[model samples]
Target: MVALHRFVVLTTTLLLTSLAWGETSNPYLPRARLLLEELRYAEAARALDQARAQPGNARDTLLEILELQGVVAGMLQQPAKARTAFQTLLVLAPDYRLKGDYAPRVVTPFFEAKGWVGDKGAALRLEALPTSGADNLLTVQVKPDVLNLGRSVRFHQREAGAGWSEQEQPLTEGKASVARKATRVEWWAELLDERRAVLTSLGSDTSPLGALAPGAISATPAPLPAPAPVSPLPGKQPQVARAPGLPLRTVAYVSLGLAVGAGATGGFLGVRSNQDRARVVGAPVDEAGLTVGLTQREAFALDARARSQARWANILFGVAGAAAIAGGTLWVLGAPVNVSATPAGVVVGGAFP
Candidate 1:
């Protein structure tokens, strides 16, 4: 009778354990779906977390968790978190697109993130122009803007021996140039996230650096020789030879670029400020009709922000103008001054008498 009792107890324990496992092993999809319907966003997020915590969840199941997490975070106004979640999704499937059922606001940020890291996107045309007087020099122009601020544009040249020369520069104001003896040169760009990890790379267009003009024929010309020094005149004070200061020109160009950038920013801010003014005029209403999901206080705050931005833009424009004027003055007056290197460092003096 004791042995019989022991066998029955053991069987009951095994049955209970089996039932528990059966209930827990099932996926969490149903739970999450129910939570979403109730508009319990936080709870739904927690449900997805629970699903991820479980061992042996299928790949598809995990993917769905990420997707839902992004959607929830976006709805909650957590853009950074949503961006991170979508980034993971893109890593898994580069071409992944969110379902159409999701709202436009939620889906928009996802694609923008994808485009920043994805292979398919608009590419800028890079042209290599040979400067008028300099043969070994190639000026690279990436017109307009650098496309992405966080990206780096690298310039490379193929050596006569075997490999490429390691010389590169970041794309500043969408322009760069390289001087080298190599007959062949090319350029490529890379995109990196804040963590400094390379997210994507754009292949070099293979347009040779020696091409004189856009769509012109490619050619390999000999390296230009250095100009011979001019002889000093006899009897008079030996005049110091001077080349036009390039720093002045760079400052001028950079100032001009800044002016353009600042002007564009100011124009945008002015338009936005006007928009806010219009919104203020039509409180709770837009040109189309009644504006939904917005309040008067919110509109006022936006208008304030727009005003502040416009002010900042104007300040930057002022700085740009001043810098341009200063730079222009310097460039025009950048005739080389006299410098005599002595045993004690160096000394600057007025132009040769």
Candidate 2:
């Protein structure tokens, strides 16, 4: 009986230790909350610091921590610190609101931070305008301009199946140009501070803007060769002779058919990718900062699958663009022409090669 009791006590001790360790591993945020409720403003501020130092905190977690840090600083009469915390939070989430009922001290600084952000126009936004004609240039405009911000815009671009390449440009003129050299291009822009930290962004790595280069239909056709010099005989009028080019009508039709099929497949895959991405984005997180209803491995697998499908969709779209260009070029080159001698002059029918 003594031995059994000792074993039971040891097991209970070990179990409690394990639970305590698990809680402490991610307890900073919750501890800060409790400290705030108990009016331990200084201790809550320290807890918020620890929480921020912890890596891999979710966006929601960071937001909560920032708000709490701002409140604690305000309660402690640190106006500058409180304003800094609130400003960082506002930059990350422009529409974020303070949840609980706070004293005028806390609310006052938060609103002041809002006004500072507005005055500085710190809300960075990027907009991609549509290209016209056969221009292969993509124009990205920065909202409110960054010339006075003492910051630069960084652009991340990549072709399908290729790694990302970054380009940093100072938006002195409020806009930058990206050359579209590939069939499918993925790109996103970020507003970077002096320390190269991201302040705000338009798109992200997982969700990038895609653009297709203009096809051959928008390109100017090559000029045809000058007609051979006609020889005039004593009694026979000058006659022009031309040999029919290889029949490309059939080949062009086949290429167009393939393009249609590939385009349809790409569209279907893109839809599936978006659906999977939505599911991953909408997954709920529990108090322990873990995704609910799905294991971590399952969530990772879903994300990987979504990325794979998106890549494949981009590849198919590229293939479709190439095929369509080929078909259009062939159709233009193979168009037949009819020539007839008339009293007025020689008349030509059909499209000019």
Tell me the lDDT of candidate 1. 0.56
Best by lDDT: 2
- Tens digits of per-residue lDDT for model 1 on 1-353? 99999889766754564353233342665566556656788988888777766654443555566777888776666767777777666664455656435543455446445544443333334455446744565556653222342333355556434555545555556665556544444544433323233333345435333323334346657689999997444433443545556665677677777777777777777688667655543444345443445453554466467557667767877876786687677667565666655544556765432
Q: How close is candidate 1 to the true structure, as a TM-score?
A: 0.29
For candidate 2, write residues 62-90 as lDDT tens digits.
Answer: 67778889989978877789998998877
Model 1: worst 10 consecutive residues (lDDT sum): 190-199
Count of residue pairs whose backbone atoms collide, per candidate: 0, 0
lDDT against the true structure, each candidate = 0.56, 0.71
Pairs that collide, model 1: none
